[model samples]
Target: MAGVISGHPLDTLRIRLQQPSSSSSFSALKVLRSMASSEGPLALYKGMSAPLASVAFQNAVVFQVYAVLSRAFDSRNGRDPPSYKSVVLGGVGTGALQSLILCPVELIKIQLQLQKQASRGLGPMGLIRRIMEREGVKGMYRGLAVTALRDAPAHGVYFWTYEYTREHLHPGCRQCEENTTTTLTLGKMLVAGGVAGVASWVCCYPLDVLKSRLQGEPAAYTGILHCFRKSVREEGPAVLWRGLGTAVARAFVVNGAIFSAYEVALRCLSSYQGGQSPSPAAE
Candidate 1:
């Protein structure tokens, strides 16, 4: 929730910038200015409710799924240091499972965010009702396959990067996996999480562009490959990389905050489990 709240403005910008309609006139600066000026600053967070409502639960699912899959894939079950391969595989499973719940939430978010005027004043439930009215339940899952494709390998790379970076950052430590008792320097944790986010976003932004298009403009394109070819043919290859800057920037901040919070939460949970409490600074 903290990460999502902090990053949503940039996310809104990134989504707008990724759309097919974002022409030469719609640079990041211009989009930001236009939205703020016309719709008020709050427009920057137009679609945040959907994600905000679900992010804690979503992240819970992500970490839980990743932990389970990691142990399943690793012979040592994280008794020994975990392998990068197992980490990636675990991430893949986590992301695939995440997509099942995420697809509809994101579909609603895209619709709500893409609305031109806040004067329309459509909340998440209203948007969902509109979607159901127009296309029914199947419409809610518009970008499931694309979201899975984008997320699976991206999340694989994501967890692998985090694990690799976090491990090397404190090579002397045994490193914490499920053990919430172990802690690393907060700064290093932030770096690992931020870099992991950047790696994931950069690795699969093209698929994300395709997803936004599919979900945002359902009638515009048929399927993933068709959408890709059409976007490339019409907008050139650079289209796929549109909003890459905004996303990368947002990813760094958002994931950094997320991991930091995650660590803090773990310590809190551990403390409640009759383990050592975090220091004042950590608290």
Candidate 2:
């Protein structure tokens, strides 16, 4: 929740800048200034409710699924620490499962964030009702296919990088051992999570841009391939990375907070449970 709140402004700008008709000259700072001056400072937090409401549920599902799959893979391989291949497969499973819940939540969030005028004050529930009335249940999942495509490989990279970084950063530390609820310093957790977040985004940002475009109103492109081709042909390849600056910044802050919080919570819970800590490793 804290991470989402901290990074939402950047996400709003990223979504806007990914739009087909968005100006090429728009920077994150420029977008921030424009939104503040034209609307209000609070405008940056538009569409925050949906994400805040769903983030816990979303993360719970992803981590649980990833852990289960990773354990299964490790058992099959008869390995104590799972191979990179197993980690990637677990991540893919996590992403695929999470997408089913994320699609509708994101569809609502993108719509609310992209709204320019206060006159069109459609809250999340209102927008959901409107989508259902106009386009049926499927409308809520406007970009599920692209979302799955983006998330699968992105999460594969995300979890793999996080685990790989944790092991290297804290070499020989029992805390870094798999299936241990060992507490890590906040700094270590931040570094690992930050790298994971940035790697995930950098690897799959273009797909995200396309997914946003397909979900947003006044849809310009027909499908994923058409969106890619049209964007490159008309706007050039640079357009695909329009909001990368803000995204990277957000990744570092939000993911750092996420991992730190996860570690802290696990440690506290373990301490509370008569010093019997469960493994903090998602795997």
Candidate 3:
């Protein structure tokens, strides 16, 4: 869960940058520096608990479901192994399902991070109460549509690119090549994960922008379509790319670490389950 833990702080910063009006009335960089100065390095990590929980649960479920669905697709199709299409579909399904499950926790995390003194005077508890009282249980899923749309395709890119990279990098596919080994080399994993990150970001950026706006400042956006039209009309086309640099950087770091960790973890788990010594090639 290093990704879930370390990444939320950046997630908080991304949210802050995307919705500058939600925080102080300063430029994005200035507000970020101000928060660092005022609240110490730790301040950037507000509302981290929910993400930790969410990511831990999300990764577990996504990985498990992806494996199961991909294998099932392969078995049903009578292919020797699953095709890349199966992997993409599995990733998409896992992402959509996880987004639906994690939306409430995600909404609370964003609301906690974004609530300004002048806006609503709502603390975390107050925000939760207000949402529950006014919008009912469904209010916690405010940005779920955008999240699912973004994640399904984004994850499809991730899985497809990841497998494609591994397949290409390996010498042969018959014996589960070195690239697919549990102890996959750091360099290959980094390259694969980095490419996947770019693939995901490029394909899903518009949806991500919509999700960020919806989560960080709901009032600023009536809905996804309205947000898109208003953004295009008012802020020029570049509005959809707000905070893209930071997002790219965040994705590079976070997704790289996530992929590496996931591969390493899966190797360990698989070895453990098989009652075998850890593969030296894996480490």
Against the true structure, whose lDDT is highest?
A: 1
Tell me the lDDT of model 1 at 13.
94
Candidate 3: regions farther than 4 A off:
20-28, 37-40, 75-79, 117-126, 173-183, 280-283
Who is ahead in TM-score, 2 or 3?
A: 2
Clash pairs, model 3 backbone: 183-282
lDDT of 1 by residue, 169-252 (tens): 877444554454345778888998999999999999999999999998989989999999999998889998999999999999
Number of the top candidate by TM-score? 1
Stretches > 4 Å off in candidate 2: 76-79, 173-183, 274-283
Q: Worst 10-residue stretch by lDDT in candidate 2? A: 173-182
Model 3 vs. true fold: TM: 0.85
Ranked by lDDT from best down, the candidates are 1, 2, 3
Clashes of 1: 0
lDDT agreement with native, every candidate:
0.86, 0.83, 0.73
Estimate candidate 2's alpha-carbon lDDT, on a 0 to 1 scale: 0.83
Quote each prediction's TM-score.
0.92, 0.90, 0.85
